[model samples]
Target: MTKIPTALLLTCDAQLVEIDLPFGHDCASSAERRAVLRAALRCDRFDVVALTRQWDMWIDDEGLYNHPVNPAATALAQRFGFTHQPYHGPVLLTGGPDAQGNTLPLLRHQVIGLFLTLQDL
Candidate 1:
């Protein structure tokens, strides 16, 4: 299965997860999705990668900082032990959309300016 070398922590919600850098597609079971997260973490170029649910309205309106499942997202952070702080202004959230207009259900934090921990990265 070629699982990722990095450690895996279960988020509070138990649905999502956060992986540390030096990350690879092996972190995720799905190749495509894993690639996306790996790329985002590696780039460290973007400020943040907002992940929305497929049917989230924000996809069309483009006005969601975090998704309803953000609690779950937070859980993911805690699970991975990724050190996190309050987000500053002018954050960008982007993702796919669904029938109701919801965006994809996942977001990745790039942490451009500051660094992060493996547990919280």
Candidate 2:
């Protein structure tokens, strides 16, 4: 079975504010994923998390400067060996996949929570 991709937005306090993209999204297309991400950025939140079989990214404004990775995101990514890519104004947290070709949901949630916590600081 193909795993569905999902996106999540979290408040600055680790609360789940929104599910930007729910399961069953057309994650197979990078264009579709980018479109969803662009739409999610229009919201008032500073943190967004994308979870898919292709890639997983933790988007946050904190990593816009000299740091290639957001501190909190780095720590979390280190735990899972995820690669940190820099985005225009947010950090792109990318990582390896599991057996199902999906980035683990637990890791996605944990990364979002961590990003939110760091934003509060």
Candidate whose lDDT is highest: 2
Per-residue lDDT of model 2, residues 20-74, tens digit only: 3422335565455455555544422345444444346556444354234234444
lDDT of 1 by residue, 1-121 (tens): 5333122222223322333423223444445544444353232223332332311111112213332333433433344343363222222223334464332332333221112332344
lDDT of 1: 0.30
- Candidate 2 similarity to native, TM-score: 0.35
RMSD of 1: 14.1
Worst 10 residues of 1 by lDDT: 54-63
Instruction: In angstroms, give how far residue 113 of model 1 lies from its true place.
Output: 26
lDDT (CA) for every model shown? 0.30, 0.43
